[model samples]
Target: MNPCFFYLLPSLLLIGFAFQSFGEAYETKPLACVLVEEIGGGGSSIPRTIRQTPVELHLIDPLNLIPEAPITSSPETLHLHVTDPSGKLLSPRLSSCEVTYLLPQEVPLAWVRSLTEEKRSPRALGHPWYSLSVKDDASGNTVSAVLGPQGEEDDKLTVFLAVYSTSATLYARLGDPLYVPCGFWRGQQFRSAIEWRHRALGDGKVLYAYDGRLDRIEEIFPGYEMNFSTLQSQGNASLLVDKVAVSDHGTFLCTIYLPYIRAQRDMQLEVTALPTVTFLPNPLFARPNEEITLSCEASHFHPLEISVELLRRLPGDSQFSVLPGVSLSTHTLNKDGTFSLTASLSIIASPEHHGARYFCRVRHISVPEGVTRSNTLHVAGVAGLSLEDGMYLFAVALALYGSLTFLHRKFKLVIGIHESKKDE
Candidate 1:
């Protein structure tokens, strides 16, 4: 034998063994089919039907998974796992499968299950089902499928998912623009009918409605607006209130309808108005040693709950302290669902209190930092004379004295009785 024959023989054997193993693994890989239902249209309504496509389970690329036809109805237990074209679960149950329900955005829908041979299917509820992912624990292979409503084989099927805003409650300032977000994700191709309704009182009222081609805005709902172009192009069915009012504070329902599917979402809107603050008796004046009441009023705020603090900074104090003997009045309800309140502070006026700064600090949900209105105390003298009055009296007396001195000088000059020429 040649010297190199031994090396060549080992290399050829290793290559043959690798190829045999690859062939065996490929042959054992599971094969399944995904069932998809789609609506056909060609200027006329086409009946809905299911189409089947075969796929190698382990060879699927999870990242670039394409959405198949929409599922028309919620999945039954028998339909929990992927099946072959004949509507049968893949045989030879290769270990347990981990199933995850998902939204259109690929977000897990708060429901997950493990499918064993005995417990392979479980019912899911709560949110409208959109997409599903099934993974084989043993093989680490995943397959995703989109779901919609199911209809009869010969009937048309409508596929829809009601997607609500993540935020359940929205706050808007009074007289400001208010946006109520809502939209829908559909598995099939169809025109959408959108309606925005508000329920604040007895019955719900429609603010805006669109029927594919034409839009109907309620005459009573002025300043309500929507962008039809955006809604058609992007499925953005949000409603815009040009100016939010007390009447606009309520629960808003956005409903989207397709041929055979209808879905809706509701959100709460709360309107907040900043209170108008004022100090009663604008020019605060008090007599020395007299008891006086200083009142601060905060009016036209929403949500009822309010906090009032009467703070006082004495004539020589650097920081204001919470004043004592302060009382808040009961809240008064207004016609438009706003509230008004008065906070009073009673104190004895004295010279020490003169020129002191008094602050009325109002706090509410609308104004987190709080609003403050201040007034300076002007205390009159004990003898019923204000500081300004005393200054006026002093000026008058000085003028009289100057006039008397001038007259006396003139009289002396006139009596100049030349009888005194004393040299000094």
Candidate 2:
């Protein structure tokens, strides 16, 4: 056998044994289980089911508490008895039951034998921790009971969180500044660490984390910033996100840490984009008897509730108004999940329509009220009149000239005849 193989074989055996022993030690051998129903009096007992503290079952004092058979008839009392693998029953003690005390401070439990003693105050048990007792039907003895470890939570500190807004959801347009607010309601001085993470992104990308005592900040994303200058002193750890983008939409978790305690709050971000509005064809012109069409397009806007309308400013009109009979039409959605709307206005060009101005008005939640106007169509007017009207005007002028010439000749003939009669 190789020398290296002999050395590695012993190490592998030790590793396997250690793992086997660890698994066996932590195996779920629940000593006591209870089925509790809500009796609904709100006074003392925990309403829902609470299990026995996972303390070592064998370590419990046999004189004070003993294992009994699983109690099926009595649902009011906690069932602490579990049958062994060998089918042997370890009898229960009537004087006491296994109990765990959960209190922020150490308070000695006062064991009572009966509920008829009106002098018993639950407050006497502890300020926050209370005791529940059940009577042994066979022995008529009362056993004081609780769940979890006694005084296990006395050294534990709690961290509380308070958000700045009732609704943690916020909406912002793309390329706009955004703020997500979070703060610690307690333990400012003991605040050891603070973190901001994108929960939707699986928390792999930590936005920011700050160490107060060391006064160091680690910004995971290059552009993201935390308001640690003023907010850190005030127990506020809000993030000021600039030029937010579509990829920034997600639930962000803010965590405040103090020693062994920590708390978190979630804030949701939604990013939307504004549309680009323009006329489809520019510098419009028309002739007499011609039809003119105008299309106003709003492109690349999210949330398809955009309003589009056609407007016209006639000659001598100061303001533009909604042009009647113009219908706004929408087309198929764009590939980027935005919307495009077009409003067309057709005009049968006449002499009266010359110099008339047209507008394409668009309104959306992303922008203020505005109109994009088209060029004034130079329709054929008096300067460039229609061929038929020009021919009619020419005919009327010719008749008037001929009538004037005829009247001059007739007056001359009458004057010549009068002069001849005078000569005779």
Candidate 3:
């Protein structure tokens, strides 16, 4: 008999049992209840039956938050939802229940012993859309509900409502750019116009505009610049401006009002630049006791400043420790057109500096360029005593003394054995 047969039989048996159980649960008439979730520009529906017999579940879409750009959607969660005429329960089994949709974060748990103090009262539901049917076998009572106001339907019945994380956070880097391509169609070849406007940022600060009607602001205090990029066939829009300074940074509104659907967005803009490093590699290959200098350069920027420090990275790793007084050394400074600062690296390292590396730093400068460098200086010398000759002499002397002692012991033992045999 094949040993593999034993493993195959158990697996097949389990799969068959699961399928049989699942089919039985859904085979009966009216489903227990239906759960519907309106989230992430879509809806997920679950059909369930709640009864000793069979019950039906219904899904309602009166709000119509199912299409693109949903508003106040159902949070993703496990909600303890109750319907009108909530069913009473029996130990280990529910009198009546319904499949409900909720953001996982909004799960209202009535199972906890803390419900006596109005626990789970402010059940975290942005809206009340989950409703269902329930039956109480002990009292022969039945409950049903219709989508109504956002709160417990016909209060008096206390239960847990499902919680959810309906909204996802969108992240973006400062000064980074995103494009809204033109493929936004309204039919024919004629392009539809989109306008970009900004408010609450001290008027007249339009980062971009469609229809090519932006007036340049050269004479204004700390002037502004704007440029527009045509979108693909989708009727979208694109725009760019230099600096994106704080005086002009804030919420930007893009409105494309159509004959039917109006589209708009309040995009937040942030400006970020690369850090400038003012350090260099020690050009001179310093043999022990030789002097050399290492250095780098950097410039200052508005709205953000840079920090400079020297780092000596540890061997076999990518981590570095800031040299005790990297910026304390002598250096030169000048600003021809831009803010410039240069530091130097002095070469004469002590015997303890055998593998010591020296460098400079210019940290946290927003220059749209990130730069860094280092210098390696090896101190050449006989740093330690040689053990080869001393160890060689001591080993030879020990070997000879051991051999002589062993020969004397062996001869004495042999002679004693002969003398003893003769006496016997």
TM-score of each: 0.54, 0.44, 0.33
Candidate 1: lDDT of 124?
28
Runs in model 3 lying further than 4 Å from the true structure: 1-193, 198-204, 207-235, 240-251, 257-264, 275-278, 284-295, 300-307, 313-320, 326-348, 359-371, 378-424
Taking the tens digit of each residue's C-alpha lDDT, what string does model 2 give over 293-369?
A: 77777777765677787776778879887777766775658765556777777767676867677777677777755
Candidate number with the higher TM-score (1 or 3) = 1
Q: What TM-score would candidate 1 get against the native? A: 0.54
Q: After superposition, how far is residue 240 of candidate 2 from its true place, in Å?
A: 3.0
| Model 3 Cα RMSD, 1 decimal | 27.7
Task: State in Å the error of residue 200, model 1.
Answer: 3.0
lDDT, candidate 3, equals: 0.41
Q: Write the per-residue lDDT of candidate 3 for residues 184-290, one digit (tens) a residue.
A: 32333232234556555467554443331122221222333323333433233534443344433455555432221233444454433343454444332446677
Which candidate leads the pack in lDDT? 1
What 10-residue stretch in candidate 3 is worst by lDDT? 161-170
User: In order, what lDDT does every prediction score?
Assistant: 0.61, 0.54, 0.41
Off by over 4 Å in 2: 1-161, 165-173, 188-192, 198-206, 209-219, 249-253, 257-274, 300-304, 316-342, 345-347, 371-374, 382-424
Regions more than 4 Å wrong, model 1: 1-159, 201-203, 213-220, 382-424
